[model samples]
Target: MSNFKITDIVGVIPALITPFDENENFDEGRMRNVVDFLIEEGVHGFYLTGSTGEGFLMTPDERKKVVKVVVDQVNGRVPVIAHIGAISTKISIDLAKDAYETGVDAISSVPPFYWKFKDNNIFKYYEDLSGSTPLPMIVYNVPLAGLFGFDFIKRLSTIENVKGIKYTAYTHQDIHKAKAQIGKDFMVYSGADEMAVSGLFNEADGIIGSFYSMLADVYVDIYNNIKAGEFSKAQIKQKIAVDIIEASLKYDYYAVIKAAMKWMGFDGGYVRRPFNNLSSCEEEKVKDEFRKIRDRYGVEDIRVLKSI
Candidate 1:
């Protein structure tokens, strides 16, 4: 297994977006550029093939390939956690094993969804996947998948090799409570980009979110400011991030994220089928708004709104 400790799982990890070419195939060159850019910008780690990476839309083979590419590209510069969660328990186990073979630092999974599964079913899913690989398991507690409350999270924490969680809910209180009740050794990464400061204030070990792919430097600043107890500085950076996120929310979330990446010079291509790209007019509007924010905040080196 990887030498990744639970402590290594902390910081500004991007829920990395998978780049696709015009044909909608995985764009390996773009992917490598993204990996390099984020690392250079000072991100802590990478969480691959999660919701932001379109894991659910990708086939099992595609997901495996993406994990291998990222693992190889990362080359141990930072820890990589591959989100191998699939609808089927067996598929998740298979993906976990593949991720392990490819040298990912850890594996994470959203509880099996679609069909209404009871708590016991979810527990069994985690139990089976955790045993299939030696890598540490980070539970993806996304409330949209169905809220995993403290009791359930506490129970999951008890499982063998289940090291931490990617807590995506807006409830910052749960993060503080989890740290208090689940123990500080249990790593909790805040998955909301807009609440990076609030999450840190509540004692979340780190921040992970979809937007971090485009704005790693901003979140890294937020993390460092929080760690340095520079709350005011962190809040200033957080406000800039919130403005960007709120602007994106005006359009389809994933589509705008991909477009913004392109505007930033990364060009992550379009969101997959069932997720449409922004119209030409919509794209121009987004570009204009980002330009305004960049000038307003005197932001530079962010790669966004550099030129209108």
Candidate 2:
């Protein structure tokens, strides 16, 4: 077994959704249940408080609670990496330290997104974070919600404690360049659910995907088949996995993830404020599509299809 290496944490790492109660508070109990479910479903590890987890939406204390709950439930059974990025290094460092205190396997942080940071600022930010906590750190390189660009990754790689990165960008050149610069010791995780296979082929040690909780069996099967040299089955599994993502994208990304959680047994609910649930009209359409998947497997998925 690969223990605590960055590459060892690869494969089907679910960017878990933060469930909120109707009062718009995080449902900690439901969150624990969700972690248990993913562990049972065969996910490799957790990519907490990231894009899929709506990390930006929660308070620092609330986010820390999510990490603590997951680490407690997992209890050293699997790797649990908490996403610790914040609008400021103070907050990010706080979260990273908390993640260390909570017994998580590692901590990851996205570049500060307040303004377009210079390469030096970005480098200092990560180096500061990597130094702030004892836990291994993976830097997240994404400009969509921020200004840190490809050049930032190249520059940030200079930091010694910067363990690796989560590549969420769609550009293949960015992936190639990061791998080329970071070298084999620094792990690269595929952040796009739809590009897991391509990313894997392109040297993504594993995938950190939003869909892995509900669609985990498919990912596990795909990884297993591919490793077993069953390319045909792996391709078929990847196709189905992509089809599921295509369907989920029809609704809001996070909403559909929560919907999928309910469809399974985890009871993950709608996203908190500023990010709403799937519209009633869209929910029906999603239900029908989910049913198609469930009917084939003969499994009742409450995390994905709650009412049924």
| TM-scores for all predictions | 0.96, 0.88
Candidates' C-alpha lDDT? 0.88, 0.77
For candidate 2, the lDDT comes to: 0.77
| Alpha carbon lDDT at 87, candidate 1 | 85
| Alpha carbon deviation, residue 255, candidate 1 (Å) | 2.4
Model 1 deviation from the true structure expressed as Cα RMSD, one decimal place = 1.4
lDDT of 2 by residue, 13-65 (tens): 88888888888888888888888888887888888988788888888998998
Off by over 4 Å in 1: 295-301
Q: Look at candidate 2 and tell me the lDDT of residue 153.
A: 71
> Model 2 compared with the native: what TM-score?
0.88
Residue 162 lDDT, candidate 1, scale 0-100: 91
Task: Report how far off residue 234 is in candidate 2 (Å).
Answer: 2.3
Model 2 error, position 182 (Å)? 3.1
